[model samples]
Target: MKKYNCIWVLLCCLACVGTTSCSDKKSSADEQEKGVTTVLPDTKNEVTTQILKKRTFAHELVSNGKVNARSKADLRFETGEVIARIYVKNGDRVHKGQKLAELDKFRLEQKLSQAEDALLKA
Candidate 1:
């Protein structure tokens, strides 16, 4: 009885393997047939082609945004003196130790004289 049971299980396993192999071959054949079928574009559709030519193309961009500088500096005078003249305008490029504006020389001289007098008095 045990031998018969073992034989029965072996037969069932063999049948399953055979069916699986046959299905695999059928699927491969179907794939081959599908691969051989070429899909052509619609003949009714129209396509226009232009000859290649060398030409310069210019691209212009128009945008609106706030631009921030990579580096910024806050300019100020050591003494509270009026500005007499400005040499450069806003958004102008500057270098180190460059004079951007001049102080009122008349007022500065007056202040200097006053300080000298006060020092003498003291």
Candidate 2:
């Protein structure tokens, strides 16, 4: 009875697999008979031609993002003073000990003169 049950299960599995494969083949044959077609563009007639010339081309990229420096230095004056002149703009390359901007010379001179007068009185 156990052997008979195993044989029945095996036959059922074989029938399922055979039916699935036959259904797939039938659907594929029907699709082929429908004859789906695709139209390709005519390459010869639609071809674009350009004369090659030796010229310099500049590529510019516009983007919206924050750029960070590899090494950054926070610049500040030791004393609070108005800026007299600026020698460089933003994103300009700078070297070590380069003078980026100058303090107001006239105001600095006045401070020095006042300090000298106070020292003399003391």
Write down the RMSD of all candidates, one decimal each. Answer: 8.9, 8.5
lDDT of each: 0.89, 0.90
lDDT of 2 by residue, 9-35 (tens): 999999999998777467778888789
Candidate 1: deviation at residue 83, Å?
A: 0.8
- Candidate 2 off by > 4 Å: 1-67
Clashing pairs in 1: none
TM-score of each model, paired residue for residue: 0.42, 0.42
Candidate 1 — what's its lDDT?
0.89
Clashes by residue pair, model 2: none
For model 2, the local distance difference test gives 0.90
The candidate scoring highest on lDDT is: 2
**Displacement of the residue 104 alpha carbon in candidate 1, Å:** 0.2
